[model samples]
Target: MTTHLPDAAPTNWVDRHAPSALRPWLKLGRFDRPTGIWLLMLPGWQGIALAAAMESRWPDPLLMAAFFVGAALMRAAGCAYNDIVDRDFDAKVARTAARPIPAGQISVRQAWVFVVACAMISLAILLTMGPVAIGLGVASLALVAAYPFMKRITWWPQAWLGLTFNWGALLGYAAVTGRVDWPAILLYAAGVFWTLGYDTIYAVQDLEDDALAGVKSSALRLGDAAPKAVLGFYVTAFVLALAAAWVGGLGPLFLPPAALFGVHLSRQAARLDVRDGVAALALFKSNSLAGLLLVIAMTAGMWDGPASAL
Candidate 1:
């Protein structure tokens, strides 16, 4: 009997529609929870949008599509790698005990092969980008390799994840312009705080399990102050994003959508309930919309001539 992951919806396509023989493989790659792909992909999209807007055009469709596919593959690979490293701890956690590795649906060797396959395909897509992007893509491997160990060493593993996941901001910008810029750096910083906020919310679901298993996370660190901490993280992210816009000379027309983006983040922070795992998961998933809102704001910023909002 295959076990549906606790965090995955019961009706997830992997469980409901994927061929039974392939379910374990798909689940190992986390195809059952696509929100992660969006979360990972959006930063790259935002970076592409910012670069294109600065060039006075919309984001390139080809680049956007490539990032989308790359994000999916890389996220899958990262998930499998995390599973391989965390298998023992996962078995000890209620929510994670059913994962492919821990549940014995997939062997560790097979999982490693899956990781390599996904990564090689992602590298093929990366190669289509410019040299700078290709270099950044290779550099990101160091971060990915280091991430699984972060929880064991720091209470702020989410901060590390922020750095790792948001590197796409730099990679995407370089992919378009063949170089990095201040706007890309600022956008990358914004993405970091954004991840810090959302991933902390995600960590809330594992508070008890993590504690019992002796791992550290921001949610465990913040305790009842999680909401306020998230609020701070989101606010910083919002301001940094706008700063990137201003620095990029995105026009005044960017304000409306940017304001909406900030408001959406604020609402998520306000509704956070660390004690309620279900609500926390919902709040975590909602970041996908928040990310899209920023993507729109950047595009709207380009709609007008490049000038700081006044």
Candidate 2:
């Protein structure tokens, strides 16, 4: 009953290079679309970079590497869990119809096993961090578990995703500094709005499908006002991010990179066309670069040395 359903990205490695037996599993985990990995990792890097800037030091290489691995595992686990929950809905949506669960390549029980396996791997990685980071990791499970149901109850599931996705900002800071600070809080909030903006753009791709599926999304809620709503989300993210750097005392050098980051988001908002799914996806993916720019900005603040060091 396994069907060779279409992948979101036709040329992705899972489709092109993965062995047939493994493709279903890899696709289930979304390894075929690398954007989610980058999106998930950037916030962690931004957290590391922010903490490093605060200390006038380089980010810990091991910590950054761990975040990369952890994000990949956790994201996969999340996608599997989401798929299992949304299997019925996925069968109805063209974009998700070919997914492992919906296409009958994986049963709900098998997907649950995969989720547990991924979670265990991610937990092992989480345990390598400090007690504070470890606690944060455990706390994050609530958000992760609750996210799939958000769309069923609220019009702003993307908002819930915003809260869930960027938790690394707090966890990363705690990992580096062993505690939370105001700047870290601001950075986390900034990431929330950033997710809100980009995920809303991503939802544009499934507007009609989501409507037909009875799933609520910001895209459906905003209707023709989605473009303006995206602008508002992006603007709020930029302002909060600026405040985070300023409060962290990252120095004036943070301005240029931050400006560049804002500009990238601005361009996405400016060019967004809800009716154009291809363009919406492209704009959504561009946030990865926008996130990298913010990380660079945070890291660059250390170049002049911590203001205290100077």
Candidate 3:
């Protein structure tokens, strides 16, 4: 017999207001847990914000709007694809056993159709950007396609996810400026470590199940050192973000907010209890706020004037 988790927070709008017929599909796309959408969207925004700061102006409203839509669609598509690829593994993991696909709420064929629909919508948005951004968007599919398989081969699938998820930093900058630069590179690296940290926390929720199922994860690899590893990843991410800002020519006004962002990451590390799955999941979700803080810092940098003015 199959089981189904409620698939939404008790108070989530999807749970409370979505049409009954659509709920399962929406849940299959992870619309109920919006944190992943934010996490996926922010790197793109940060890249745009970084570019705008370097140019000493606000981000392009059109590009920002496009990214919001594209991020949502693409993130949904990515989740659908991941679920499709991991359905077998999902059944063996406690936290994931009740997911739509594994619980028989959605058929594999239906999920593929959903993935295709989402990708087509995202493709329409991508086509509006320059050739460089278009190319980057196409390239991202390779990462997305390979990601679900990483856990079967490596102890650090989260690292692969970091690389995949943070591709937005590069793509966003390219979309706005028609080229990738040092600042974009740095920002991409920063996002990678940020994902590494948060994803590791997320994996903590499945440590025992993963171990039993022979899945590999950073949480499993780090063992008792997971907290320290989280701190290390966070610190690296903070430093790289600062470097990206500096390279983008952000002024002194960027420092305070950036420091605050660092403090938030540090606090997450300090408070982490890897053994507590609830706490681990909460900390993972909190990175959504952490992402917003980075966005604020980057946006503040826009008006602070360029590095030469500092």
Candidate 4:
């Protein structure tokens, strides 16, 4: 029996929503896939929550909203840029052949225009943040611009992704306090490792295709040891996240959620079959749940009082 790859609904939806001329560019940015947006937003929210825990205040709703909008636009822009750069490579992969650039639905020049439009929207959101947050946000553009080429040069493009994705942790704290601190750094590191583990699982689905295309990935690097590597990364992520919470003085309510996150990670590691692409894609999508669970844990930890705190 053959397993079908997960269909990208957003790509399809965007294609339907856009004009015939614009559909391809919109699809390139994956406006229809909201999971990437959520993944991007969570770390920023985590940072905001950690700051709230330290200050004994609720996380700022306005800041949260801004980060949410910023995340969506930036993620879309990133996708467009990636598709444009990887058009040839994406065409070669069965899973990505339908992408706008590879399908010749959009030109590279058109994609650049779309990227600029998205960046303008992202910039509008950034201007609302504090100077420190703004600086961090500005710095991320370099990472975003460079990411598409990392696969061609390094097997560890996921590490670069970790660096790019978790930047919100820094921005969130800076938005709240206008300064960088140890707690935010710890949370950022944890987010990086978490991304590393999940993205490695995602890469597993493309292992054979990636190998044939000469693409590098952590999944390819680990081979049979991928499961164990995932375990190690998750363990580190949990430990670092816990340490960040502790440093932020988050109460005991965090312990239960953290423990639950550990269980989830263990389940993922135990169930993973690196050689099974369909199974790998399922497992990769499951990380959205894992990430949300950890966010819940973090939120509870931040909300739970000192008396009931772990």
Candidate 5:
């Protein structure tokens, strides 16, 4: 049987059935824990929905499929790159010591190869999008490259991750609308704050290990106030999401799901417990549902449209 990482679900498919030789590679990409992929991809979907609503049309299934593939590839690449940069720190942390890199399952050079392969595939998808979306995809490279170092130099690496992961919102909107409008920007901002909240909760899982490894995080920086900080971040995220809907001229039908989204976030904050890592992880993973709700809110906004397109 495959040895599961501390963070991976025991029954995850990668551990249950993946070929032994490929298991290390899949783990390197965090395929054993698919929550990150959903978190990374949903912002793009929300943007697609918003852009479609703006045009009073349904989101393009072809474009959505492309983004789904691209997001998975890019997230895998990003995770491999992060592992390459963070091998040493990861070795020092109990939660990360068994990762493919730190545990000797994959060589740094091999991981680099994986990163390149995934990034090249993602680039191929980007090339099929509009010029503005392609440019935004290229620009996101800087954020991805800069991310692993943020934990070393900043107390809030989650903020940088927010910027990096949610960039898909802008790119997706540009792909459909061929322009970066106020709605996309606002939606991107909301995604950033949403990430800030959930990732802060995730960081709680590493508070002790991170502090011991000398890695700074919003959770460690806030100390006992981590939950409160998460609450603040979620509040900002909820407000910005609504603002994006309003500015995008969404109708009243969007409010109910949006309210549910807000309630979901509120409950996460209310139940947050900095001392409980398992609960923190559960809370972090719940953001996927929250992201889907926001996507629904955006889709619901298109109740009235001049015309419709698939």
Candidate 6:
């Protein structure tokens, strides 16, 4: 007997007011899932923490707040753009069939207007940054606009996502120091690997749907050995993040958080059941914890000051 689980009830006020057609668009961009925003925000925090280590102060709360808001707006914009581009493809995939445009809830023109409004809000936030940081923020638009197409042409679209999502690390450093540094680059690279790792796990949920629809992904590319690939990516992310902290001149307190993050990644990899979509999603969401742990570690390391302060 097939047991039918009820459609998930929408809980938020925005979700309720969302045009029935726009609902899928919002869901497609993961407005329902805040984890993507958290992932995007963490790299900005890392940059802030690294900058604080350089200045011998806690990271600026105002700057962090700006990043938080900017990330939310920009991530939403990116999602709308992606859905507009991928609407047909999304409709063919079971996992994405109900997306706003794919489900006939929102028109392409409407999605475009939504995207533009979100971009305007993001740009306003960007203006609050220094000229160099603002330029970096604006430059990121090129990457964002092109990302929805990368999956059509390349199996490594996740790499493109890494480049786009982690741009905040560079912007964070620039916002504080008004310049980029090796530590920020390393942190950004680490975030890229981190994104690749988690997003690949997320892709596992759509593997069959993707295969049927001719969609390419790291999960499909790695095939049965996806778990191993995830492990390698997570390991690289951890190593690069440690390099970023060291280059930033953080103190010993950073080690505990770093160690804890490593443990957490390993645990996720161990518990991951690639064949189960539910399990895959659960593991994927757990990455927010991984990102948070690193932020805490980096924050603590910056707070204590470098050895010179002692």
| lDDT, each prediction | 0.92, 0.90, 0.88, 0.84, 0.90, 0.82
The best candidate by TM-score is: 1
Q: Please write out the lDDT profile of model 4 over residues 1-310, one tens digit for every residue.
A: 2233643743456656667766665567776666788888889988888887778777888888988889988998999888888988988888899887777777789889989999999998899888999999999999999999999999999989999999999999999999999989999999999989989988887887888999999989999899999999999999999888887778787788779888888888888888677777767777777777766766777665662255
lDDT tens readout by residue for model 5, 38-130:
999999999999999887888898998898889899999999999999999999887788899999999999999999999999999999999
Candidate 3 worst ten-residue window by lDDT: 1-10
Off by over 4 Å in 1: 1-5
- Candidate 5 error regions (>4 Å): 1-5, 304-310
What does candidate 1's lDDT look like per residue over 237-282, in tens digits? 9999989999999987788988999999999999988778888888
Worst 10 residues of 4 by lDDT: 1-10
Best by lDDT: 1
Candidate 2 stretches greater than 4 Å from native: 1-7, 305-310
Cα displacement (Å) at residue 150, model 2: 0.5
Candidate 6 lDDT over 1-310, as tens digits, reads 1111112224743477877655665674577778889988888988888788767678899989989988988888889888888888988876677767877777899888888998899899889889999999989989998999988898978888989999999999999999999989999999999889888888888887777888888888988788888889899999998888877888888889889999999887777666876777778888889988887887788656564432
lDDT of 4: 0.84
List candidate 6 segments past 4 Å from native: 1-29, 303-310
In angstroms, the error of model 5 at 130 is 0.5
TM-score, one value per model: 0.97, 0.96, 0.95, 0.92, 0.96, 0.91
TM-score of 2: 0.96
RMSD of 2: 3.4
CA lDDT for candidate 1? 0.92
Q: Please identify which of the two predictions, 4 or 5, would achieve the higher TM-score against the true structure.
A: 5
Worst 10 residues of 6 by lDDT: 1-10
Candidate 5 vs candidate 6: which has greater TM-score? 5
Task: Candidate 1: give the clashing pairs.
Answer: none
